[model samples]
Target: MKTKITLNKYLLVSLLLPVLLFSCKKFGDVNIDPTKSSNLNPVNQLVFTQLRFAGDVTINERTSIIMTMPMVQQISGAYYNRYGSTYIKNKQYMSELWEIGYPNDVLNIADAVERTQSDPLKTNLNAMCRIMKVYIFARMTDLYGDIPYSEAGKAYATGIVHPKFDAQKDIYDDFFKELKEAGNSLNTSKDAVGQELFYHGDISKWKKFANSLRLRLAMRLVKVDPEKAKAEVQDAYNSGLFTDNTDICKVDYNNITNGYAEIRGNGVSVGINQYVDDGRPRVCNTLINEMKQTNDPRLQYIARAYWTNPDRLSDRLDVTDQVKAQVGLLGVDAGHYNYDNFLGAINIDYPGRGTISVPNGGQKAQLADFLVRSDAPFFHLTYAEVEFLLAEATVRWNLNLGGNAKTLYEKGLEAACTQLSLFPNGPVLTSTQIQNFKQDNQLAPGKELQTIDNQIWVALLMNAPEAYANWRRTGYPALIPAITAESTTTTIPRRFEYPLSEREQNAANIEKALTALGGKDDWTGRVWWDKK
Candidate 1:
């Protein structure tokens, strides 16, 4: 009887065990949210990455407007602008790009590239990802030398919580290789990428962009590695480039006011417009004066001003009145505009200020409405830039880039002018006006390189980082460093310092990078390609 009872208990326990285990498993699944998944769609990931690249308000404000734009002397007259205009160190502004770039743009794009690598159906998507990865890293390495390249964006896949910073030289080499491979890999016969932001999955356009970017990167090597630069430029040119304005790589943003978190609106436009009443930036005399001196037709489209009264919204005067527009087209001298005495010294009178005596913040020109609208297109790479690079290569290396330096230079100027119409309500430059400007601004005999780079400077107006990079490489337009009592340094900053977070979280790798940088992590240090 005892043996029979024991056997029956064992048999019943065994039967219940499987049922209990299955119940626990089902309960575990209930805790997991069905709406959330570990797997990411590569197409959606790519779209998000592209949008964040152009639509990060923090980056646009801290890096571009406050730092690069003022450093390049394109725009100024804001208190925050002192960081670049007067060479004052603001660690927050200096580190924003590195801090934001890695976690957001780098991580997502890297994942997309990795996920699509083995899928046969995702060939074009993979190619686009590769090209975009290069673009993102190039901008990063250009600004902050020796960032984590190979090991970046691999935290989830490889458990690399801390990535090693690769040398800029090695990174550049990889950039060229990746661009070449990606450009060649692009196939129209493959599945079209529905979520592409820059080109809408247009394989041909993507191909042109990749090569044009290669040409631009090659030009950066002029002072560092001329042999490599020439070879790369020749190869990229021969491969094919942007034939016209339509091939320009850009993001046309919608007029959305959902703040920085919203990716549909242009972050740069939102950034600049936020300070419309306070510390509003006026076009720098360096830029406006250059345009005025050259009789550049784009000046009318690029700059405008209003008589502003911060106290009253309705008190602003429109630039449509030709008389007021002419008077308000004044560009402020950067470092000099911060003083109270300087503000008092300006004798200009605005009838719309309610009282001409009040010197409301509108004493100087502001960026035009069309240029700063929430929907303005952010130009990533353009045919104008490609033409200018080719022109520079022709002059510097005597390479046959399908046209003489003069012809290419004029084509760049026309393309630059023509692309402005892409902006919301942007003015159209008539063919005659473009031709007249081209005729007047022809490349000078002794100053071919200078002329080409100066126009490159003008063409890259809103894209401040690119303009700053070009200025560093070519030293065109001959900017004098801002001389002010408030300045922390006499020289312009060559590159951004590493983020403070790197010091706290990734100390060892950052220390290794600092050692390579001669044991200092300051803006004065030059990147590899920016050799003096």
Candidate 2:
């Protein structure tokens, strides 16, 4: 049985409970508003944080879909893709993750952790909050490098109006410490953590998630600090890791077609599918060709071509016929002018090829309907990722992670394919198909790192932040930067520029961070763990 948690009415209540209970107070005063009761439930705050972490449309659209996805060459051709695919910098788009993440995700979880940490009855809740706090900060520090970590979200708590920017190394060191402490603290004998979103209050699953997340962060240090990476990876591996697909960490959103403010639906899905027919995302040739070369069984399930109606250009007909489907499964090449001339390139006549509607507006291969549904699950971390990381550790550091690299690599492949079923209406692979794919794609000798990282690229579909980070760290599935004259830079961006608001509001701290970034707030500057 699938171990997925769904959003419900109680979760909605949990979302609004804190807001109803607490009111804002002026800075330099006590954190709690004098008008309302000081008593705020940490469980409600935890639920709200978890929902917003996966449900922020601004972050999902600006960072994941537009910026990270195209930068990684997973999908392209949408108007917003220029920001990442063609390297055109947009301050608003680049800053969305930081602007939204700090106020919405980080603050809420930080508050929850603070509220529950000292309470004996809230031990499990506090542990979950701490784990979530680390998860939120990990993404922030990964994307923007040094950020307001030690004092972030403390404005209301400790009157820290302008927090200092903590270095990425310091932030990562704390992440390992927090994850370890939190994972060790989760106990079934303690609080039940009512209205839980991820695991439905399953203490064991939360423990595994903490370890899996720690392993991920540990592996990110492979280039910058190999010894530290090996030690952390081995420690996280031995402590415990996701054993199978059932332990995959994800948030299953309800089928609510609400706006960006609503946390009941999948934000990434809403962002991608919200675009009109002409503006919908098309699979990039990089991803399509990668799968095509390997005869990947997931291609059909993940991508599809649509037929536009001649009478009504906005109407799209799903190309269900197999023969025509093959001819229509064409992906847009990044930085090409094909975004405007979609029909001209794929105008071939097939047996079932219907008449083209707008001569210049043919449908390219887009994500499958089920994959983009508003109710689709947002994958936080997966068992496949843990397995792949283990495989990499074994190959790169020669660590005995309970199995050889080949065995772990195959298991990772299997888990990657199998985990798709967790999504609403997602594809389910047969045992035979899984085995055949594994057999056909054995890890190449002396190319194990590249091969494993390449599979990781495929496995991280839709989760673009992780995909972008892994590409930067491993440099696998070598990609050439888009060479168009309209591009903003000659290379892929290493990190997002700090928000302009940071300069205006917190000038000193932002300047200190920028000084560490070599006196410029630009994408070419690498994060601490991202070594040359």
Off by over 4 Å in 1: 1-38, 309-316, 320-328, 338-360
Q: Which stretches in model 2 have alpha-carbon errors above 4 Å?
A: 1-6, 10-37, 309-316, 320-328, 337-363
- lDDT of candidate 1 over 1-532, digit per residue (tens): 2312322333333233223222322233665533223345667666666766767788887889889999999988878788889899888898888887877778777877887999999999999999999999988999999999999988755779999999999999999999999999999999898557788788999999999999999999999999999999999999999999999998777666466655566788777767656467778888988998889999977776565534322346654244343344566786646333244323344455443332434546667778877677899999999999999999988998999998898889999999988877788999999999988888878999888999999999989999999999999879988879998888999999988888999999999898767899989999889998
lDDT of 2 by residue, 357-464 (tens): 333334567777777777788899999999999999999899978799998999899999998887767899999989889887888888899989999999999899
CA error at residue 288 for candidate 1, angstroms: 1.1
Whole-model alpha-carbon lDDT for candidate 1:
0.80
Supply the TM-score for candidate 1: 0.89
Q: What is the alpha-carbon lDDT for the whole of candidate 2?
A: 0.82
